[model samples]
Target: MSLKSTHFHSGLTTHLIRRGSLTMSYPRDPNPTKETFGVGARWDVPAEKVHEVWVGNEGCEYVIGE
Candidate 1:
């Protein structure tokens, strides 16, 4: 049997490294709706409220009140 290797985009790798200290609990969602707090949201905010305001978003790097 052959082992399959996984690959990540350079940008994604860079992001991971930059945010290495952060604990990424969420999965890599290709389509993170506002309901899930896609990104640029306050960490304390509930995922539901986040989506209510920010819909169709992506890349959650710098969180509020960190």
Candidate 2:
């Protein structure tokens, strides 16, 4: 399964696979932002430090909030 989130500004969708926890961007436009399109489209964070994955207009962030 996947965890999906939508960006407020771009309205693009970003997802993370529960298996690998890899961040991915699902663009809805022909020309998408760098964070939502391109060859290097996925990112992985250290699971220990990641409180959660946040998908925003700026892209996925490793939430470290307490």
Candidate 3:
């Protein structure tokens, strides 16, 4: 499926599975940082932090779970 953006709440751990290459972006002090994940990659967001994820590549898909 195609997804544009996902918002993760603070104090909740979120699990992500990538079907293709994608990027997760978050705000920082002076600039925002981005992390890319490849196909079949799994990423876990720490419960203490809030994050926003954005799909960076065309045809990329992401599955998110809490």
Candidate 4:
């Protein structure tokens, strides 16, 4: 049902759902199955184009940049 990945520094387990591919994150809670937490997105970029990558991590996708 999900593709899981581990982040050592964060000590959090990330799972990628196969349906919509939505990413979910947990605070390494002791009870993973019963604990619900926030989520984040992941992307793969080339070294040459790293600077050009942009994401609306804070959920501000509507406000235009002045």
Give the lDDT of residue 38 in candidate 2. 26
For residue 25, what is the lDDT in candidate 1? Answer: 27
| Residue 38 displacement in candidate 3 (angstroms) | 1.1
Candidate 2, residue 14: how far the Cα is off, in Å:
14
Which regions of candidate 1 deviate over 4 angstroms?
A: 1-35, 43-59, 64-66
Using lDDT as the measure, the top candidate is 3
lDDT tens per residue, model 2, 22-56? 33333544554323322334334232321222244
TM of each candidate vs. truth: 0.16, 0.22, 0.57, 0.22
Q: Model 4 reaches what TM-score against the true structure?
A: 0.22
Please, what are the lDDT tens digits per residue for candidate 4 over residues 1-66? 243443333232223222222333333445433222223333332222211111223321221111
Number of clashes in every candidate structure?
Answer: 2, 0, 0, 0
**Model 3 segments beyond 4 Å from truth?**
1-6, 14-18, 28-32
Those runs of model 4 whose alpha carbons end farther than 4 Å from true positions after fitting are: 8-19, 23-27, 34-66
**TM-score of candidate 1 versus the correct structure, residues matched by position:** 0.16
Q: Residue-wise lDDT of candidate 3 within 1-66, one digit each (tens)?
A: 235565556655545556667777665425878787777787777664645666655566667666
The residue-by-residue lDDT of candidate 1 on 1-66, one tens digit each, is 122222332222212111212232222456643233333333443332211221122223443321
Superposition error at 64 for model 3 (Å)? 1.9
Instruction: Please give the distance, in angstroms, between residue 41's alpha carbon in candidate 3 and its true position after superposition.
Output: 1.1
Query: Whole-model lDDT, candidate 1?
Result: 0.28
RMSD of each: 14.0, 11.9, 3.5, 13.3
lDDT: the better of candidates 1 and 2 = 2
